[model samples]
Each structure stands twice: as C-alpha cells, then as structure tokens.
Target: MLRVFQECPELKLSSHGRKMAKFGRATPEIEGLVVASGLSPLIMCSLDTGDRRLMSTFVEYWHKETSRFHLPVGEVTITLDDVTSLLHLPIIGVLHSFELLHVDDVVDMLVELLEVSIAEARVEKIQCHGSYVRLSWLHDVYQMKI
Candidate 1:
C-alpha cells in the first residue's frame, strides 16, 4: 500500500467510495506507512486520512455531510523535504480553521479538508483562495500565508 501510494500520491483513495479498485488497494497502505515512518500525529494524519470524495470516482458522491457551515476551506502548499527534515524532532503546531459545508460542497469540503490535513501534517503554509485553492506547508515554522 505504501509503495503504491508513494508512487501515486494523487490517486483517489476513499474506501467509502466503493469496492476498492485493484489499484485502489494502496489506499490502506498509508496507515502502515505512517506507523513505520514514526512521524508526528500531524504527519500521520496526512498519510492516513483524506477527503472521502478525493478517493471517490464520482465527484457527486463526495460531500461533507457533517460540516456545520460552509467549512473554512483553504489550499495548503508544503514540501516533503521541509517536513521530513524534522525527523526525530518534537512537533508543535495548531489546526487551521475550515469553512466548508457538508452537503453539495464536494470541492469546497475537499479544499477545507486538505487544509486541515496540511496543518495536522505540520505544513508551514496555506493559501486556499481564488478559483483554485492554493495551500502550502513547510517544516521549521507554521507560517500560514493564506
């Protein structure tokens, strides 16, 4: 699973979407990788969790029914090197706010989710705005540039 996800990090990997595609099986591998990597909880969150619809094939099927309001959504930009650079170092950070709705808000929720994931993963930056959400996270500092 880790191998495949590592190879194709962008593959939609929502187990709730449907029967796992032959190639989709890699989705679960992320959990094992998180454990093996011994990364911080934030990093683990990034590897283990993702937007349900991000993993689903049908765009319409992806929606955050649990969100109370238009979730505070944002795009985050981060670098693997920036994070991995802190190996064995204690992590300190906070969660970014998300404002995306659950129903009929697939793209909005995904963007918000990605932002949260970035924060949990110790991302250093975020800029989710405009037509395309732009979020960036780096290591060393939690410098959110939204």
Candidate 2:
C-alpha cells in the first residue's frame, strides 16, 4: 500500500526563535517525543543560508531517536541492518557495534533527491526560509469559453 501522509506540522525546528506557521493540513503533528524530549520547537538557527538551515535540520539528530533504538513495530531491538534496508543504503555512522565510513551519506542522498547542488543553491535571500530549487510549468489544457 502506497500511503501518502504528511504531518500537519511536519517538523518544528525553531530557526532563530520564529514561530512556525501551522501547515493547515488534516493530519495531526508528528509527536516524536521520546528523543526530542528537551528540544524547543523553534531551532533559533544562526546559519547564514536557507539551504544550509533546511539541510541542517535533517542532519542533526532529533529528540525522538535519542536514548533508545525505537521503531514503529512493537519489539525494540533495531539493527543498522534495519535502517539501512529501509533507506536502501548501506548504513554508515555511529552504528555502536560496527565501523564504517562516509558518515554524511544522508546529506548526499537528500541533495540527489532534490536535484540541486547544495553548493549553488546556498543563497542569501533564502536565509532561514531555504530555496525551492525546482520549477514546473502547467499550460492551460484549453481556455474555457464564457
């Protein structure tokens, strides 16, 4: 089943202590509580560029994943094998039990998925807000006659 769901307030990383506009979606907030225990909703970011700020949120560890290896399923004990398979990439980073290289593989993955060079998309105006690097055109199928 291809379930397409988004958290109404997907992520509440407080950048520069600004309030997040509620996304106005139907779904409830994604309460990643256990790991994100003490983290404030506003991130208060001092990063200069928008892309960096946006990417930083993903790179940093969220509260929910801390202090335990909790997964959606009932049983707890999760292995790097599990995360690696889900992400479809070999696990790399502090695996706690094994050694591997390329700790920031996820950053590369995000950049590729967005199809933009993080180096180039880093701009001043987009500071904090970040860049919407993709563009699409939708031509009128036919003009409606009034």
CA lDDT scores, all candidates in order: 0.36, 0.34
Structure candidate 2, residue pairs in collision: 14-42, 14-43, 14-44, 15-43, 16-44, 16-45, 35-63, 35-64, 36-63, 36-64
Q: Supply every candidate's count of residue pairs whose N, Cα or C atoms clash at under 3 angstroms.
A: 29, 10
Give a tens-digit lDDT track for model 1, residues 1-146: 12122232445643322221212222234446655545434432223455664443333322346322221253233345555454443344554465754332534433354344533332222243322333222211123422
Model 2 CA deviation exceeding 4 Å by range: 1-66, 69-75, 92-126, 129-146
Q: What is the C-alpha lDDT profile of model 2 across 2-65, one tens digit per residue?
A: 4344443444443432222221211122234312332222222233355655554443323354
Position 72, candidate 1: lDDT:
26
Clash number for candidate 2: 10
- Which of the numbered candidates is closest to the native, going by highest lDDT? 1
Top candidate, metric TM-score: 2
- Prediction RMSDs, each to the true structure: 19.9, 19.0
Query: Model 1 segments beyond 4 Å from truth?
Result: 1-90, 107-146
Please, what is the TM-score per model? 0.15, 0.20
TM-score attained by model 1: 0.15
